[model samples]
Structure formats: structure tokens, C-alpha cells
Target: MAKYNDKELAETSKFLSFVLRHKPEAIGIVLDREGWADIDKLILCAQKAGKRLTRALLDIVVATSDKKRFSYSSDGTCIRAVQGHLTSQVAIGFIEKTPPQFLYHGTASRFLDEIKNKG
Candidate 1:
């Protein structure tokens, strides 16, 4: 799981919700509800909000977010938000393609291994 101090978590969550609910239109870039936002645009938004758009901050947020909230292509060249609440019981592979790598597994390796064997 992604680790963050209270401040960082709050900031990242706010940023995510802001983008998801309002889209980029509020900041002059027009984005459809389910569209990608470029790094430059994200930086711009952070700057506009008076947040420092440092590489460290960006990396922390991306690394720490739940995989269900976002996705990136195999090469890590493109990213988009996954639709819907993470807790909803839906098909595991609802997104177009399987993720290039697994992000998190809830419990210990022994448990995951048991699950894998059972399935």
C-alpha cells in the first residue's frame, strides 16, 4: 500500500477529487469526464492552487495512490483514472487490459498464494 503522512494524503486526495469531479475545464483545459491529463496540465493546476509542483511530490502521490483509482500504460507513458468506487464488487478485469504490474495485494504472501491456487 502507498504510505503518506496526513498532510500529503490530504493534499493528494484533494487533488484527485478536484480533477475527477470538476475536470480540467475549471483551469482552462477541456477534458471529457474520462480522459487523461498531461503532466504539464497537472503542474499548471498545482501552481494555480499555490501548491509546489515538485518531482518528489508528484512521485509520492502517484506511487501511493490505490491502483483502483488510476492506471498507466505498460511503458508508463500514459495514465488515466479508473472509473467508479474501488470497493464495488465488479469484474476484476473491467478495465480494457490487465495492468502491466500488480500494485497491491491486501494480505500476506501466504494468503495471496492461497488465493492464487484456489482460483
Candidate 2:
């Protein structure tokens, strides 16, 4: 296995996040409102970013990520971020079987209320 220093890891993580933020319309995967970009898109984006994205590299990054950064289907066709990593004040809904309609975070209610009152 290849080992990376702290700087390299941080750069890779940031790059991963950036790739996940955009959707690859060519591949027909749409990123959710939250920053969950598709896995295929991520690979392509990595390639564009000059990173040699391979199955092994992908597996290594996912395995070593401390924040649980990425999530993918068993088949590897679909991918997204695990959620809640982008913003400390936000909540992420990760229940694949039965996802919540609205994430129930303490700050969310207050934020929603403020939005509603403004409207």
C-alpha cells in the first residue's frame, strides 16, 4: 500500500470533496441538494485533476478516511458523501433503506423557522 503524508491526504480529501460537489451529466448521475456527488463523476473528476484514480486507490482512500467521507453502493455504480461532513451545523440523512424526509438537527428547526418567518 502506498503511504501519504498529512498534506497529501488533506489535498486528496479536498479534491474528493470537490469532485463530489459536481455532477457528471454525461453519466446521468445527479448530485443531491447536499454535496453528494456521484462516484463515477468522482473518478472522472479525479482523472481530470491529474490523479490516477483506480479501484485500489479508491478503496484505500475510502478505507482510510477518518470522516467516513464517501459512500458507494455494493456494485460501485452509485456513490455519494456520507453526509454531515461538509458543515458542522448541518445534519445528514444516511439511512439508505428508509431515509428521513427531513433531517432532525437542533439547529435545523431554528433555521427553518427563520426562513418561514422571512417568507
TM-scores vs. true structure, each candidate: 0.51, 0.49
lDDT for 16 (candidate 2)? 60
The TM-score measured for candidate 1 stands at 0.51
Candidate 2 lDDT tens digits, 59-102:
66777889888867777765666653443322455456876798
Clashes by residue pair, model 1: none
Candidate 1: C-alpha lDDT: 0.56
Q: Which lDDT tens digits does candidate 1 get at residues 1-119? A: 34558687667656664664345454554343345556566667767877665445556666677655665446654345566523222223445867767576578776887788895
Q: List lDDT for all candidates, in order.
A: 0.56, 0.61
In terms of lDDT, which candidate is strongest?
2
